[model samples]
Target: MQTAADREAKLQRHRLRMTLLSVANTSLQSVIIGLYAWAGEVGWSVAWRFFLVGAGSSAMFALIIWRGLNLRLKDPGLLLPQIALSVLIQLLFLVLAPKLWVLFLVAVLVTYNFAMMSFSARQFTLAWLLVGAASALALFAARGRFGHFGTSGVSIAILWLFFFLCIRQLTAIGTQFSSLRTQLSEKNKQLSASLERIQELASHDDLTGALNRRSFMQLLADERARAQRAGQPFCIALLDIDHFKTVNDRFGHLIGDAVLKEFCAVAAASIRVTDRFARYGGEEFMLLLAPSTSSDVARVATERVRQALEAHDWDRIAPGLRVTLSAGVSQLAPDESVEQLVRRADEALYAAKDAGRNRTVVA
Candidate 1:
C-alpha cells in the first residue's frame, strides 16, 4: 500500500536523521578533544588533528549513508533492514567513547537498533545477531589492548543512550507496520466481497436469478470436462412456455414477469441436484441432464415443471389461466461440442412444438 512517494519520504527522513545524528555525536567528541588541546595541554597542532579526525569520520559516515540511499532506490523493501543495521554500526564505531562501559552500549545498540528492528520487519535475525556479536568481539579486543578499569563501564553508558534511541525508533516502526497491515487486510476483504457480488451478477439472470443463456453454455463446458474425466452420462433439454405471449397480452408486462419468475421456481425445484437449469432466453428454459436415459428424464422433468406451474394457483392475477411447455431433450455424444449438443436438442424441441402444444421431444 505504500506508494513510491511514501517510501521515498520515509527513506529521506531516515537519511537526514541518521546523517545528522552521526555528525552530531562524532563532532561532539572532536570538540571535547579540541578544547583540551587548545587549553594548551597538547598545543594547536594536536587540536587541529583531532578536529580533522572527527570531520573525516563524519564524512565517511555520511558516505555510507549515501550507499544506503542508493540501495533504497534499487530495492527499498528488500534492502532497508540491512542498510539500517550498517548505518547503526557506523554510528557506534565513530561515536562511542573508549571505555569498558561502551561494551554494554554497543550490545544495546546491536540488539535494539539492529536485531530488534530486523526481526520486527521479519528480515534476517540471525545475521544481525552474528554482526552484533562480531562487534562485541572487536570491543573486547580493544579493551585487551587498552585495559579496562573495572568492567565494561564506558560501553554500558553508551548502551543506555543507544537503547533509548532504539526504543523510540522501534515504536514508530511498529505503529507504521500495524497501520499498513490493517489497511492491506481491509482491502483484501473488500476485494473478495466484490468478486463474489460480480460472479452472482454475471452468472445469473438479473430478473429471475436463473442461470442466464451465456452462463448456461459455460456450465456445459464445465460439465463436459467433468463428464469426460469421470466417464459420466448426461442429457439436456430445452423448453419454452406455451401461450406466454397471450398472458402478456391479457395482463401486461408486470404480470408476465411474475409468471416467468413463477415458472422458474417450478423448473428449479423439479430438477435433480445433478441437473442444470437455465433461462435460455425469454419464454424459454434449458435443462441439462445427468446420467438419465433418453426421453424418460426429459418426460418426468418437463411434466413436473409444467404441472407445478399450472397448479401453483396464479388465478387471482388471471383467473382460470392454464400454462404448458414444449421441451427438447438431448444426450451427450462422444467428443461433441456444446453447440452441436444444444442444436440437436433445439431441433427436437421444435419437433415437439410441431407435433402438439404440450410434449417432450428427444434427439
Candidate 2:
C-alpha cells in the first residue's frame, strides 16, 4: 500500500512534468523567432516578430491547457481534434518563420507530439517515414540555395527526426505505465469485493439467505451505534420456525430447508425495503428496521410478517409438513445497545414459545 507521502510525491512529480511541458511549448515559439533573426534572412522588425510569436504561443497553450487538463484517454473521440490543432499550429510556425529553418526544424520536432499520442504506433511510424523522405527531398532542393550538404539544414533535419523518435519512445513508455496502473487498481477493487462476499457467505445462513447469529449481532451493533450517534431509534423483529424440528423429523431436513427458504422469502416480501432480515440461528431470524418506530408499529409489522409466512403454501416444498412462524418484536430503548434490544426480543421469543408457541409476542 502506498502511504500518503508516497502518493503526494508521485503527484508532485507528475505536476512538475506537466509544468515543464507547458513552459517548453510556449517558450519554443520565441526561440524559433530568435533563431530566424540570427540566421539573417528576414525583412521584418525583430521586436514585432517576437511579440507575435509570444502572443500566438500564449493563445495556443491556453487552449490546450483548458482542453487537456481533465481529459482521460479512455474517453473515446475526445482530444483527437485538440491534438490535431496543436499539430497545425506547429506546422504554421514552420511556415511563417522563414529565416530560422532550424526553428522550423524545432517547431516540427516539438509539435509532432500528435503523431505519437493521437495516432497508433503504426500510423506514427508511417507518418515519420513520410516526413523523413520529405525532409531529405527538401534538403536536396535547398542544397543549391543554402550552404549545400554542409549547411545547418541537413543537421537540423536529422536532429528533428531524432527528437521526435525520442519523444515517441517516452510516450510509449508512459502509456504502458498508465495502462499497468489502471489494471492494478481495477484488480485491487475486484479482490476487495471478492473478500467481502466470502465473509458474507461465511457469516450468513445459506438456506434463508440471511445473516446468522454472529453477523446479525454485528449488524445490530452497527445500527445501534448509528442510532446512538444520531439520537434516533431502530426497531427489530425476532422470528422462528413454529415447528421446524417437527417438520425436519417428519418430512426430512431437505423439506425443512425448503420451509426455511419459503418462510424467509415471505417475511422478506412482507417487510418494508428499509428492513434488514437475517437468520439469527437455526430456525430463528432477526430484522433490523431503520429510522425507528413505536412498540405498536413493530408488533403490527411482526404479526403481519408471521401471518404472511403461515399463509404461504409449503405443500409444494414438503407435500405434508405444514410450516408456520412465531416472532418476537422489540423497539430500541433509550440509549440501549444491540445486546440489550436483542436480549429483550430473545426473552419475548421464548415467552411466545412458553405461551403455546405459534404466535407473535412483543417486548
Candidate 3:
C-alpha cells in the first residue's frame, strides 16, 4: 500500500511536469521574437542587448521555477518573482523596439492563462497589476519612438481595455463550464448507483437476501456447462427446515420468519465464501458448492450446517423455540444435466427426512 506522503509526492511530480511544459512553451515565444530582431528582419536596429536580455531572463526564470518545483516547495511567492521578471522583460523589449509592442500583449496573455491555471487570486492580481503598470510605463517611454505620443497612448489604452474585458469573459465562461461538468459527473454517478441497486433487487430474494430461485437456476445451468467443458465435478445440496409447519403453527408467522432468517444465517456462515446459497422456495434452500469442492467436502459442509442450527441458541428468538436443518448432498456426474443433479439432491433430501429429522444424506 502507498502511503499518503507517497501519493502526494506523485501528484506533485505530475503537477511540476505540467507547469514546466507551459513555461517552456511561453518562453519559446520570447526566444523566437528575440531571434527575429537579431537577424535584422524587422525595421528596428538589431539591438543585441534587448534580444540577449529578454531571452536570457526568461530562460533563467524557467530554470528557477523548474528547480524550485522539483525541490517540492509549495511557496506561493515563487510566482511573484516571475511576474516581476515578466514585467521587466516586457519593458525592456518595448523600450528597445517600440514597433514590436504586440509582443507585450502576447506575453501578458500567456502569463494570464498560466495564472488562471496555477496561481491563486492574489497572485493573479499581482501579475495583472505588474502587467498594467509595465504597459503604461512602456507606452510613456516609447512616446516618440512609435508615433505621436497622444495617438499611441490612446491606441494602447483602448487595446488594453479590450483585452482585459475579453480575458474576464473567457475566465467566467471557463468557470461556468467547469461547474456544469462537475454537476454532470455527479448525476452520472448517482444514476449508475441506482441502476446497480435495481439490478440487485431484481435478482435477489427479498425474504432471505439470497439469489432468487430463477437466478439461481440460471447460474446452476451456467455452472453445469462450465463443469462439463472443463471435466471438473461440482456438488449441490438441498436443505430443508425440519418440522417447519409445526413451528409456524406453534410460534406464529413472525417467529417462523425469524427462524428462517436465523437458519439462513447459520448455513451461510458455515459455508465457504465461494459457495452459492439461495432460498429454493418456502422452507427450503439450495447450496451450490464450487467446482473444486468434492462430495466429501459438500457432505462435511452440510453436516456442519446441521450441527450449527442444532446447537444455536434459539430461545432468544422465542421462548423454548428450537430449529433444525436436514440437507441432501449430491455430486455432479460427468455430462449430467442441471435438472438431473437437482433431482438426485431432492431425492436424497427425502431419504434424510425419512431416515431421521436432522441429518445429512449424500447421493
lDDT of 1 by residue, 45-69 (tens): 5435544654555566566666664
Quote model 2's TM-score: 0.53
RMSD of each candidate relative to the true structure: 8.5, 15.8, 15.9
| Best by the lDDT measure | 3
Q: What is the TM-score of each candidate against the true structure?
A: 0.57, 0.53, 0.58
In order, the Cα lDDT scores of the candidates are 0.66, 0.66, 0.74
What order do you get sorting by lDDT, best first? 3, 1, 2
For model 3, residues 168-222, the per-residue Cα lDDT tens digits are 5456547746966897899899999999999888888887788889999999999
lDDT of 2 by residue, 109-208 (tens): 5545534434777867776775666556544544544421225774465446445654654575478468768989999999999999899788878677
lDDT of 3 at 62: 55
